[model samples]
Target: MKRLRLPIPFSIKTNMILAFLGVSLISILILNLFTIHYFSEAVKKDFFTISGEAQSRLNYHLDDYFKQIASSTSTLLKSDLNQSWLSGKRVHTSDDIDNIQMELKRYVAFNFPEIIGMFLVNREQRIISMTGNINTDSLSYRNEPWYDLPPNDSLVILPTHRTAYPYPQQNGTPVLSLLIPIYSTDDLNVTGKLVIDITFSKIHDILGKSALGKTGFFFILADDRIVYHPNQDWLGMGVGRTDLASLSFDREEQSSIQYWNGDKMLVSVKRSTITDWNIVSIVPFDEMSSGLKAARGSTFFAFMIVSVAIIAVVPLVSNIFVKPIIRLKQVMQSVARGDFSVRAVDDAGQMEFQQLGHSFNRMVEQINELLETVYELRIQEMHVRLRQKEALIQALQNQINPHLLYNSLDIIKSIAYLENVPRVEKMAKNLADVYRYTAKYAESEVTIGDELTHLSKYLEIIRVRFPHYFESHIYVNEKFHDCLIEKLTLQPLVENAVKYGIEPKGGHGAIMVSAFQDDAVLVIEIADNGPGISEERMRELNERLAFITNHVKDKQLPQESLGIASVQARLVLKYGEDYGVALHSFPGRGTVVSIRIPYRSPKIG
Candidate 1:
C-alpha cells in the first residue's frame, strides 16, 4: 500500500492576521485591567460616601419624628392641666378625659398620620379614654409597661411591645408607648402617667410611603434589648433571644459606618431630646447608594462597549501598520529553518512595502556570508539558557524544604488531636501559617513582620512536635521590626539550628534567634547550645563558599546541614555578596549561623 502525504501549506497573510489578532487581544486585556481597577475603586469610594450620607439623613429624620412626638405630648399636658378641667374633675368620668382625648386625637390624626393610637390615663389609675378604635375594657393599665413609667420631669417613649388598641385590628401589632406625667396647677406634686400609644403602623405609614426606594424599619431599643421591632415576636427581648441580633450586631458592627449582612445595611440611631428613648432606622445598603449603583452600572457598561470597540478596531489598525513587517518576519522564519530557497514576492506597488521588498532581496543575496556565525552564536545562547534553567530548578528545590518541615508539624498536630488536647488547634494554626509563608515564595520578598509571624508559627509547631526536648527564644529589635527579607529565609535557618545544633545535645537544649538592623543592613542570627561544628568541617565549608552560590548545587550533607546551606545560598543569590552564611562554633558549647543582608523596607507596591 502506498502512503499519501498531505501538503504542508504556508501563507504570509495567515501569519500576519494571527499576529495582529494576538497583539490586539493583549492590548485589550491590559487596557481592561487598568480601566476596571480604577472603575471598581471609584465605585467603592462613591458607595461608601453615599452610605454615610444616607445614614446621616436617616438619623435626622428620626430626630424629626421624636421631636414631633414631644411637641404633641406637650400640647396634651398643657390642655389636660387646665383650671376648668380641674374644677370639672369632680365629675371624674371617662367623659371628662374623653373631651381631652378627642381634641388631642384631632391634632394627632391631622398632623401625625403615623400616630397609631392616643389615650389619657387619669390619676384614678383607670384609662380615661383612647382614640382610633380603643377597646377600653380589654386594656390593662396596671400591668402594661407604659402605665408603670414614673411620672418624672420629662416625657419618655417606651420600647416596642404588643398592644391591644385601635379596635378590630388590636392584635399583637407593634407600638411605642409615650408617657408624660400630668401635674396639677397649684401644687407641683406627681400626677398620673398620661400614656399615648404610637403604633408601628404609624411609623410604616409615614416612612414607608415617602421612602423613594428600599425596604426599611424604624424601631426603638433599650440598650441591647429590643423595645419594638417590626418582627413583633422579637420585640421586648434581649440580645441572645433572637437571631437578628446575632447576625446583625457583631462586635465590629458597632463602629463600622457601613456594614454587610449578606447585603449592605445602613443604620442610624439618635437619643431623644425628652428622655432616654432612642429612635433607630435601618435601610437597605443598596438603596442608600442607589445613585452610585446607577453610576457604576453605567460606567461598567460604557467601559465594556469601549473595550469591545477597542478590541475590534486594534487588529484592523495593527494589520495596516504592520503589514510590511509581517511579510518580513515570515521570510525571515523561512530562512531560519533552512528554507533559503524561499524568496519574497514584491507584489505591493506601495513605496514603503517596495522598500521592504528590496531589503528582502538584499537579505537573500548575503545568507552565506552570516549563516554559520549566526548558527554558532544561537547554539551557544541555547546552552547558556539551559544551564540557567537547571540552576533555577535547583534553587526551587532547596527553597521548598520547609514544605517537608510543615508536613512534620502536621503530623504532630494529628497526634495532639488524637490526645484530645486543647492546644492542638493552636498548634495546627501555627503550622498552617508556617506553610503559608513557605509556600508564598512566588512573592519572593516578605516583611520582617511576616518573617517573625512565620517563625513564631514554626516554633509553635516545633514545640508541639518535640513537646519536651526543645525550647525556643526569639529576639527582635524595635527599629528593624518592619524590614523585609526573602520569603521563607528565617524558617530554614531556625530549623537547621534546632535539628543539627540542638537535637544532638544529650538532653534539653535552647535555640535563640535574634533579628536586628544595624549599619543599613538586617542581621539575623540563629544560635543554639548543642553539638557545634568541628574546626576541620568549618574550614572545608569556608573553602567551598566561592563555588557554592545556591543550596541546590552544593554536595549533599545531612538533612540539618542541608537546611543551613539552602538558607545561606538563597540569601547570597537574592541579596548578592554582602549577604550570606556565617558560622561560629565552640566544640562543647554549640553552633550558630548568622545571615546578613541590606534591610529592604516591607513591600507595599
Candidate 2:
C-alpha cells in the first residue's frame, strides 16, 4: 500500500494567514453570539412589559364601564314608577298601568343609551313596562337560578345571552343582563325583579379600540366560557376548549409566552372585578419581534461583508511578511544548484531582511573561496599519483638489466650442473623466477594465485639459503585464488618476517600465510613464530602507519619498518581507511600481520 501525499504542500505564508484569520473569526463569532443572545433577551423582556401595560389599560377600561352600568341600575331601583308598580298602588286599571310603563321606559332609554331593553316582573308573576319582547309563558323566571338569589343589595351581572324579542332587528342578539331584586321599603322582602339587557356591542367596542400587534386581539371569558370574542363564532364556546385555556391565569393581571397550534403567542390576562371575567390579549411572537428580525438580518449582512474583507486582506498581509523569506529561499536554491554567483536581493525595507541578505552574501563568498582551495589540493594529489606511477615504471625499466643477471645465473647453473651441484642449480632457477616476478612492477594488481606462486618461488630461494633456519606454510582457500590484490602485498610481509622475526632469532622460526572471507571483505593473516616487537615499539610503529599519507608525501618511513609501512600504505591507497593492515605481537612469542580488504572476483566480461 502506497502512502498518499498532498499535491500542494502547505507553505509558511498560507499557515500564518490561516492562523490569523481563524483567531479573528472565532473571536468575532463569540462576540456576535453573546450580543445576539442579549438582544433577544431584552426584546422578550420588552414584549412582556408591553403586554403587562396593555392588560392594565384593558382592566381599567372594563372596570369603569361596569361601574357606569351598576350606577344606572341603582338609580332605576329608586325611581318612583318602579316602586309604585312593585307596590301595585299606581295601577288599578290597564290604561293607568300602561302610562306608568311608558314613562319608566322613556326614563331608562334617555338615561342609559347602552341598555337595549328593560323588563319588570311583579310578585303576582305579571310582567309590566316591557320595552323589548318578553315571552311571559316561556320566561320561567321562577325556575331561573338568578331569580332565587338571596336578597343582596349589589346588582348581579349575568353572562351574555340572546334576547327573545319579537322584533327582527332586536331579536337573537347577544346581551349582558343585570338583575336587580326589588324589596319592600318596610320589610325588605323581595317583591319583584328588574332586568336590564345591555347590548354585547358595548363590550366589543371597548375591546376593539385597543390592540397589541398586527394579530393581537382581546376576548372576554366569563365563568370558563368565552362571552365575547373578536370572532363571533368563538363566543359562548367553553374556554377550556381553546388554546388559551392551557395557560396559567390565576393572577388578576398576568402575562406569558406560550405555543399554540405550533406558533408562539404572548398572552396577557386581566381579570375584571365587576363581572369576574378575564380580558385576554393574545399576540404572536413573530409579529412582536419583526423589528428584531430585521436587525438580525442587517447584522448578518455586515458580518459577511467584514469576513470577505478579511479574506481579501489576509493574503496581502501575509505576503508582505513572507516576501523577504521567499527571496532568501530562491537565492539558497540557486546556490544549492552550484550557482554561487547569485546573491539574495536586499531590496526589503526591514532592517532584519537587509542584515540577512548581507550575511547570506558573505557566506556564499566564503564557500566559493573554500571550494577554490579544495580544487587546487585535488589537482596536486592527482599530479602526485601520476608522478608515482611514472616512478614505478622507471624503476621497472632500471630492473630491465635483470636479463644479464639472469644470463649470468644460467651460466652458474650450467657449471653447477656439470659439477653435479643440484641444490645450487635449483637455487639459481628459483632466483631467476623471483627476478622475473619482480620485473613485472608495472602491474599494480594481480590474482592472489599468481602473487602466491611468486611468493612460493621467493620462499624456496630463502629456504635454500637458510637451510633449516625457518619454514613457510600457505593455507589460502582455492575459491579466493582468482581474487585481485595489490602486487607484492604478501611478499613484503613474508620478507619482513624473515629479516626481523626469523633471521635475528638465530634463523629458526615459522611463517604461516592464510586467507579467508569475512562477510564482504577478504582478510589475510601472516603469522611468524619469532622474537616479536616490544609493546612500546609496536605502538610507535602503528602510529606511524596511521599517518601513512603524510609519511608517503614527506618520504619519512623508518629504514627498519619500511617494508611493513609500504604494504600498509599500499592497502590503504587501494581500498580506503576501513581496509588496512593491523599488527598484533607478543614479545618473545610471535607476531601476526593481518590485512583487511574488500572482496572482489575477476569479471569475465
Candidate 3:
C-alpha cells in the first residue's frame, strides 16, 4: 500500500500549533491522572477512618449494654431470694418456696425490661424456680453446661440460644444468657444457678443503630460465629462462611479491605470488652469509593475541556506568531523577482517579529537605492560607448574618402585618355557627389531618399571601377523615401557586400537593397548573391549579436563585424531592444542582412 502524504507543504504555523497541542494534551492527561489518583486515595482514607470510628462507637455502646446485664446479675445475687436459696434458711416446704420464687420473678421482671426470662435451679433440693411461661421439656437444668461449672461469683456469658420460657413480647426470639452461680456463705459450696435471658432483639437494636455509609451495615460475631446480623439468614452461620471471615481478631479494633460476597468491601472489626465479640462493620468498596469515582469523572471531564481548548487555542496563537513571518516571506519573494520596491510591514504583534520586519524593510530600501545607482551608471556607460562607436565610424569613413577619391581620379584620367568623355564625365560627377555626401555629416538621421541618392552615386562609382563585376538593385517604395533612419546605415551594409561578399566570389555577384513596411515597423533588407557565410560562422555571429544586445556593458564588438555591430548598437540606441538587425545566410548561396526600425516621417528642422 502506498503511504498517503499531504498535498500542500507543511507550514511553520501548522507545525508549531501541532507541537504545542501535543505537549499540552500530554500534560493535561498526566495531571488528570495524578489528580484522580490523589483524590481516590484521599477519599478511601477518609471513608475507612469514618467507618472504623463508627464501629468503635458501636462496640462501646454494646459493651455498656453487656455491663448492664452483668450488673443486673450482681443485683439479683444480692437479693433476698438468691441469699435464702443459697443459705437454705428461707423456706422449709415446697409450697412456701414456690410462692417466694414467684414473688422474686415478678420483682426481677419489673426491674429489667431486656430480660426474656429468669430461672433458679438447685441440684441439692432437686428443684427449679422460673419466671415467665416455662416449657419443662426444653428447660433441662441438670444437664445444662453452666450448671456444671465450678461454683463462682463471677457471671458467665453463654452463647445465644432459643429461650425455653420466652417472654410474650420477645416473640420466640433467640436470647443470650448470663449465668450466676449462688454459693453458701458458710461452706462456699455451689447451691444454685441463676440464669438471666437477654433477647437477641436488644442486640439487634444496638447493631442496627451503628450504620455506616451507603450499603454499609454491622454484624455481631461471637468467637468467629455470627451471633447477630441484620440478615437473619446469616445469623447462626459460622464466621468463616462470610466475607470478613478471614479477618484476624487479634487486635481490639482493626480495619481493612477484602472481598465480601464476591465484591470488594471495606471491613472494620471492633471487639467488645464485655463479651469478647467482634462488631464488624462492612462497606462495599464501590460504595466507599463512590465519591472518588465522581471526582475522577469530574477531573476527566475538566481535562477534556482543557485539552479541547488547547487544541483550538494553539492554532490561533501560532497564527499570531507566524502571520508577520508569512508576510515577510512574500515580500522577500517579490524582491527576488527584481521588484526591489516592495518591503515588509512593521506591524507584527511580537517585538522580535517587528524587529525582523524593520530589518527586511531596511534591506530592501538599501537594495533599491543600489539598483537606482547601477541603472544610472549603465545609461552613462551606454552613452560613452555610442560616442566612441560614432567616432570610429567617422574615422573609417574618412579613410574611405581619400582612397575612393584617388581611385576615381585615376579612372577619370584613364577614361579621358581612351576618348570616353561621356562615361568619364559621368564617373567623375558620381565620384564628386559621393565625396560631397561623405563630407556632409552634420545630421545624425536622414531621409531614406537622401541616403539612397548618396548610395546610388557611390554604387555608380563602384560600377565605373569594376564594370559588370557586381550589380546593385534598389526596390524601395517611393512612399518610404521620407522615412527617418540612422545616417550611414545602408552605406556600410553595401560596402560590406561589395568588399566581403562580391569581391570574395570572383567580383561577380548581385546585391539587392529592398525596403518594406511591416505593421508599424519598416524593414530594410540587403541581400547579396556572393560567397555566403557558413552555418557555423553565421551562428557564431548571431550569438555575438545577441550577447551585445543583451549585455551591452559586458560585451565588446567583434573586430571582423565592427560595421554590423556598430549599426546594431546605433539602432538599439535609437529604437530600443525590439528594433535591431538580423542576419540570414546559407553556405554557397547568399546572405541577407535585415534592419528593423520603427517607421516615422523625417522630422522638420
Candidate 4:
C-alpha cells in the first residue's frame, strides 16, 4: 500500500484564488464557444429582421403612392369639366385647354412630384398635357400600337412603358400610366381617355433609402413585367428574360433564399393590393458572414486578455482574503499573551474583513465588560440597601402633607361654620373634595357615576364664582352610571365648553352634562348655551380632535380646541383609535361636544 500527500495543505486563500481563476477561464471558454457557434446565425436573424422592416416600409410607401394616383384619377373620372371637354368631337380651344390644365395642375398634380404628365386625349387625337405647366397640342396617337387601351369602362392599369410621343426629357425614361375612359353623356360611349404618366424615381427613394446591405436593393414587378428596377435598363423587362426568373410569383412563399448572379440572395416579397404590383427586396447572403470573419480573430484575443487578467489579480485576491485573517491571528495571539489593549483593525479592506475585525473587537470588549459587570455586583448591593432605608424614611415623610392639608381644610370649614358664613364653608369643603379626587392615583379608570359626581362638585364651585348668570345640569342614565371610563376624560371637555362655548358670551351661559348607552358605546356629552361657534371653528375643532386621536402621538393642540383635544388624547391612549370626542355646533346655536368610550360594566368579583 502507498499513500501520496503534499508537504503542506493549500490555504483557503490559495484555494479561493484557484477556484476563481478556474471558473473565469471556463466561463470565458464557454462564451467563446457559443459566440463562435451562433454568431453567423444571429447576424442572419438580425439581417432578416432589418430586411423585413425595409420591405414593410416600401410596401407602405408604394401603397400610399399608388393610392394617391388612383384617387386623383378617380377625381378626374367624375369631373364635369373633364367629361365635357374630353367628350367634344371637335378640337379644344387654347383657353379651354388652359382652364382645364390649370384645374388638373392645381388639384391633381400639385402634391405628387413623381407625376410627369397628366394627358387628356380625345378620340380625334386632341391632347391636353399638364406636366410642369399646361401644353395644348394634337397627336396622331391612334396609329400607335399602344393607343388601344382601356378597352372598357373599367380602370385600366398600364405597365411601365414608353409613349408614342416622346418628349426629350422623358424620351429614355419609362413611366407608368393609369388610363381611364371618358364617356359622352348621351350614348355613354367612350369618347376620350385620361392617362397619367408616373416616374419610378420616387419608388427608388422609398425602397433604397433603408436598403439593408451594400449590395441589397429593391425592385417592383406588375403582372409578370418588371415595373421598376434600380438599374433603369431593366424597366419593363419580363420576368422570363432576367435573373429574377427564378423568383416565382405563384409560389406561396413570401421570402426565400436563392442564387442570383453567382451570389446567394435573400428575397422578400410584398404584393401591393392597390396597384397589383409585387415589391421585391433582395439582400446578399454573404453580408451576414462578414461579421463572422471579423470574429475569427476575436476568440484568441479574448482568451489571452482573460488569462492575463487572471494572473494579474492573484496577488490582489491574496491581499483581500488572506491578509485580514493573518492580521487577526496576530491580534488574537497578543490577547492570549495578556495584552488586552490590542484591538483588530475594524475599518480596513473588504467587507468580510471589516466584519471579522468588528467581531474580534467585540469579543475583546465583551470580555472586559463581563469582568466589570462581575466586579460591580457588590457595590450595587450596597446602593440597594441604602435606597431601601431612604425609601422607608421618605414614605413616612410623604404621608404627613396630605393629612395636614385635610386638617387645615377642616379647620377652615369649622371656622366658617362657627362664623355662620355658608359659602366659605361650602367652598372649603368643595375645594378639598376636588383636590383629593384629582390627587387620588388609586385607579386609572372610574365609573360614570363617580366622574359625574365629581363634575357636580366642580360645577358647584363654578356656580359660587359666577352665581348670577352661570348654570349647570347632570342627566346621566342610572343604567349607564356603573359603566367604566378613563378617569379625568370628561373634566377637560367640560372646562373647554365653559371656556370657549360659555365664557365667550360674558356670563349668561349654561353647561349641560348628559350620558347614555348607544350600541356598544357609552357616550357623554357636554353642551353649552352661549353664542355658539361659527361653522368653520366647529369643523376645525373636530378635525384636530380626530387627527390627534388617530395619530396617538403627543402633538401641540390648537389654542381654540385645547380642552377637547386633551380629553380625546387621554381616551385614545386608554382605549385605542375607536373611542374619541367630536363636536357638533352651528353659528348662533349652542355647541355640543360628545365623548364616546367603550361600554364596560363594573367588573364582577
Candidate with the greatest lDDT versus the true structure: 2
Candidate 1 lDDT over residue span 460-513, tens digit each: 777777787778888887666667777677877787777777666643788888
Candidate order, TM-score descending = 2, 3, 4, 1
Distance from true position, residue 315, model 3, in Å? Answer: 5.8
- Maximum-TM-score candidate: 2
Off by over 4 Å in 3: 1-41, 73-75, 79-81, 87-92, 122-148, 163-172, 181-192, 242-252, 262-264, 284-294, 313-605
Q: Model 4, 1-605: lDDT tens per residue?
A: 78986564777677766777788778877877788668745755676567667766777887677666666666665677777776675556667667788877875546676776677777766667774322333533443334665445655667777655545655555888777677776678887777777787776777668766777887878888898888787787788988778765563225555788788776667676666677777778776567766675776687678767766887676776788788998999999987888999889656878988998999998887876887798789778756763453233223312333655777898999999999999988987786677656456678888888888887888788778999898888788888888666676678777777667777678998888778988788888987778877767877877787766443333333225665666677667788888778866768888888898877741
What are the models' TM-scores? Answer: 0.36, 0.44, 0.43, 0.39
Q: Which ten residues in a row have the lowest lDDT in candidate 3?
A: 131-140
Off by over 4 Å in 1: 1-143, 146-150, 163-173, 182-192, 201-204, 214-605
The count of residue-pair clashes in candidate 3 stands at 0
> What's the number of clashes in each of the models?
3, 0, 0, 0
TM-score result, candidate 3? 0.43
If both were scored by TM-score, which would come out higher, candidate 3 or candidate 4? Answer: 3
Residue range 1-605, candidate 2, lDDT tens digits: 99998564678777776766677667767866777667656756786678667766877887787667666655666666667767776535666557656765776667767777666766665666355323345353443334455445566777766666645677666777777777766577777777677776777788888888887887778867777888776666687877656766564465566787788777767677667787777788788777767766776776677677777887888787688888899999999999999998866565887888988999999999999999999999999987885564334334322343666777888899999999999998877777777665566778889989988997898888778767899999999898988777888789888987888877788899999899999999999988999989999988877887444534534433337777776676667678878999989989999988778967831
Sliding window of 10 residues with minimal summed lDDT for model 1: 248-257
Off by over 4 Å in 4: 1-432, 439-444, 461-471, 503-509, 516-522, 534-584, 596-605
Off by over 4 Å in 2: 1-37, 48-51, 84-100, 121-151, 164-171, 181-183, 187-192, 213-215, 240-252, 259-264, 284-291, 316-605
Clash pairs (backbone) in predicted model 4: none
